[model samples]
Target: MEKKKRFGVLLCADDSEYVKKKYGGYFQVFVGLLGEEGETWDLFRVVNGELPNDEDIDAYDGFVVTGSCSDAHGDDVWILDLVRLLRRLDSMRKKVLGICFGHQILSRALGGKTGRASKGWDIGVTCIHPSPSNKLLSSLCIPSHLLIIECHRDEVWEPPPHAEVLARSDRTGVEMFRYGEHMMGIQGHPEYTKDILVNLIDRLLRHKHIQTSQAEAAKASLKEKEPDREAWKRLCRSFLKGKSLS
Candidate 1:
């Protein structure tokens, strides 16, 4: 039997596993796995605090940046170092994907800025509307509305140069964008499931990151906002099979 293709996943944080669980664990984290070309994906955890440079960064087939529970503007050296790594990756035109914190990192690394969210923490699913129509949207499994999990307090004030705004949401216009398409970043968590959204909402409410009323409002909004699962699945597959020229 032919082996699965190998993609490298530069797992970025302690909470990565927790986030992975939200998306069905290791099986659906969407991080690239690297191995003998035809082997399975091997998620390589890279703690940015340790600081890795180009030599340290070049070994992966692809790279994935995860959301950090830590703040991007805070004095976390790792976050700064990650900016360096992402800048290098961007220069090389590598297939890099950043979600949430990852997205902020990419933007900041490329001469952009990140700050607090305009609406605070968005704890449930949201509807990301495609910026305009294209092949990527052509394969979507649902309507232009994409229902995915969100939990962030910061956002990109301005996207990097050469970036394309592929999708946006009413909650946050930077819902989804492409760093050249093949290299993409999304503000929402498409990898997560409905149950995961519920579980995360539970966790956030328990910790007071969100209030009971907010959770209730978010749930009701999501019910009416998100696209179908099949549509989301189509979006994922489209991302996986990125443009040949991106």
Candidate 2:
């Protein structure tokens, strides 16, 4: 029998009661999107400073850095630790997929810059135009434009020197980017459903992170277009597993 692939999720966000009750936390959400039978998925709640041992790193087929409520540019202790860990992963050429804040942190780990989005907060379904110049896009058979759920105020201002911009949108310059074959960052939440976004929007409102008007507008956008979740799943799975695009 073939050996099972092992994956790790460096979960950055603390799960809210709603998410825990509904989806069993962000870890489960990601597993639902990327997990397959015969694969072992492990979770590391990095927000609380949980990480895999250094010697065990090689056991994982790939690692995923999840989105966080904290800013990627912040110099919090855990954030700094995460940066060091990411640097180690990069040096080893480990397959790493970063989402949202994860994307920004990965850029920072590679000596890139990250900050607030110049276009302000992008908090709804967005149409991402994958760069035609990227051979990987063509190989993955991804569509010209993919609709994805986005809820972020920060973005990667500059990717690493060797990185290629993979996708872009009107509001954000680096919607998606890749540094070599081992590292890729996506600004949207492919694992999220419309309902999860709705709940998050409510929480943001309760915490005054966004105004009611913005919340309403974001919710409205969701009704306007559905995310291309199936395509995203295939793209992520293939990239991490090294499956051919065909």
Candidate 3:
């Protein structure tokens, strides 16, 4: 019998009440998107300082770094530790997938720069244009442009020297990037549903992270279009599972 593939999620955020009740947390959301038959997934709440020991890193097929409310460029102790861990994973050539803040942190860990966005928060479904050189996406059934859920104030200013920018948007230059064959990063949340994004927008507004007008604008954008969730699922699963794009 073939062995089941094992995956780990390095969760970088605390679960909101809605996420906990609806999906059991962001970890479950990702597993729902990426997990398949004969696959097992686990979580490490890295935001809470829980991490898999370095010696045990080889146990999983790949690791996913989840989004965070914290700044990727912040000098927090746990953030520093996570950066070091990412560096170690890169050295091992382990497959690593990063989302949002995860994307920024991966860039930082790999000798890139990340900082506040010049245009302020992007808090809605935005279209991303994939690069022509991203041959891995050729096998997927998608259009020239893909819409994805985005809610971020920080952006990747520069990608690592060895990384290739895979996608870009009008608001952010590096929407997606690939490092070598084993590492990839996405600035948008492919795992999120429209309802989830709506809830997040409300939360942001309540916390004063964004103004009421901005929240209304973001919600209005959602009515105009929807994210290409199915295509994103296929693309992300193909990358994580080592499946050929062709």
lDDT tens string, model 2, 123-178?
Answer: 99999999887766787678999999999999999999989898999899999998
Give candidate 2 misplaced runs (Cα > 4 Å).
243-246
Weakest ten-residue segment in model 2 by summed lDDT: 237-246
Candidate 1 lDDT, 3-74, residue by residue in tens: 344455555666534655555453345532212234445555555454444574554446666666666655
Winner by lDDT? 2
Give the residue spans of candidate 1 off by over 4 A: 1-4, 15-28, 31-39, 48-59, 139-142, 221-230, 240-242
Candidates' lDDT values, in order?
0.64, 0.92, 0.92
Per-candidate TM equals 0.78, 0.97, 0.97
Candidate 1 is scored at a TM of: 0.78
For model 2, name the residue pairs that clash: none
- The CA lDDT at 198 in model 1 is 70
* Candidate 3: tens digits of C-alpha lDDT, residues 17-102: 99999998999999999888889899999999999897789988899999999999999988999999999999998889999999
* RMSD, candidate 3, Å: 1.3
